[model samples]
Target: MAEVLFYHLTESRLEEALPDLLEKCLARGWRVVVQTSDPERRDALDHHLWTYRDDSFLPHGTDADSSGALQPILLTAEGAQDANDPQVRFLVDGAEPAGDLSRYVRAIYMFDGHDPERLAGARRRWTIDKAAGHDLAYWQQSEDRRWVRKG
Candidate 1:
């Protein structure tokens, strides 16, 4: 099952969340593909978190070319399609929750309570009425979060 986890964090929280998120996915034996909008920040993350044997990294806007290393696949919006690698999991940072999210079997969307325009755009683009799948999730720190498997 494909899984996508999206996170919306304050710039201050990114350093904390990134490592924990990466470790969590690694512990679960999931191949990770991360998409970011910033090249420098992505490169920094690649330098710190990427290991030759366990992870891989690519900067946003870089080519889709990949090393055989198990490192997480890193990319930008233009390279997002490269995520076609099978059994892959996605971690999108500072990304709006729109687009063809149905490409993954399981996904998580994090909200930051700002960017009403982007949020509304995502709501319009990705809605339960149009998506197809068994498990769909909406998690807010304030709500009861659970997976909803389609019938």
Candidate 2:
């Protein structure tokens, strides 16, 4: 079964939390696809990954870039599941899976706790994924800024 993880963000914002997650994925030799709901978010994430830290870098590209499959990380507004043939997929900014998600080794949903709509959406996804028989997990940041599995 595919592994599905939900990250409920309360303290750190997306810009602060995502790069660290992506970095861990990279360390494991996993190519990643980050999906957002709009072009603006897609663009913003692409740029953020580049300048997130002066000492570090996450090599990534968007659909506008050439060689989509060659990128270690890809950002997109669409739900193109296999565009980059990534082992890891991230759903950001309320983006949902478009089709079959079993192809991915792991799929992560990052939602803000302050946004009720996003929280509700995460609950819906949790229910659906649980019923679908995927391995599900929930994570929340502790006061020390460490991610602890909640469910």
Candidate 3:
């Protein structure tokens, strides 16, 4: 079973925290897929990954890109079954977990704590994933703006 990590975003928004997390994934030599339910969110994240850091760039391509398999990071909306065979998947902005999650080494659910709907979704996912026997972890942002394991 794949490890499921739920990130409760309280201090930083998705755009703010995602780049650092992506960089960490890259450091581990893992390909990544960042999925959102909305196509616009995927496009916005595509742009953000480019401009998020001035000194470095994250190699990412959207599903519309022809050479998706060659990209280190693939961003797409929901219902994308083949997403570059990434080792990690990031579900942002209330995106549901992809159906074939066992293909991934880890699945991360990044949800905004301030949004009621997102919070409910995350909780539901936590309960579901927990019962499904996947290794589960919960993290919340600390005052110093770092992810701290809460459970």
1 versus 3: better lDDT goes to: 3
lDDT for 70 (candidate 3): 85
User: Which residue ranges in model 3 land beyond 4 Å of their true spot?
Assistant: none
- Per-residue lDDT tens digits of candidate 1, residues 1-151? 2343334443324444455655565556555555554666556555555442345442222223454233444443443444435234343444543455555544544334366754664454346424544243343322232222322
Q: Which candidate do you rate higher for lDDT, 2 or 3?
A: 2
- Model 3 steric clash total: 0
Q: Report each candidate's C-alpha RMSD, comma-separated, in the order given.
A: 6.5, 0.9, 1.0
Give the alpha carbon lDDT tens digit for every residue of 1-151 in model 2.
Answer: 6899999998889999999999999999999999998999899888888888999988889977777788999898888745678999999889999876788899999999889999999999999888888999999998877899999
Better candidate number, 1 or 2, judged by lDDT: 2
Clash number by candidate, in order: 4, 0, 0
Which parts of model 1 have CA positions greater than 4 angstroms off? 1-12, 47-69, 73-77, 81-86, 91-105, 128-130, 142-151
* Top candidate (lDDT): 2
lDDT (Cα) of model 2: 0.90
TM-score of structure candidate 3: 0.96
TM-scores, each model vs. reference: 0.54, 0.97, 0.96
lDDT of residue 96 for candidate 1: 40
Residue 93 lDDT in model 2?
85
What's the true lDDT of residue 105 in model 3?
A: 91
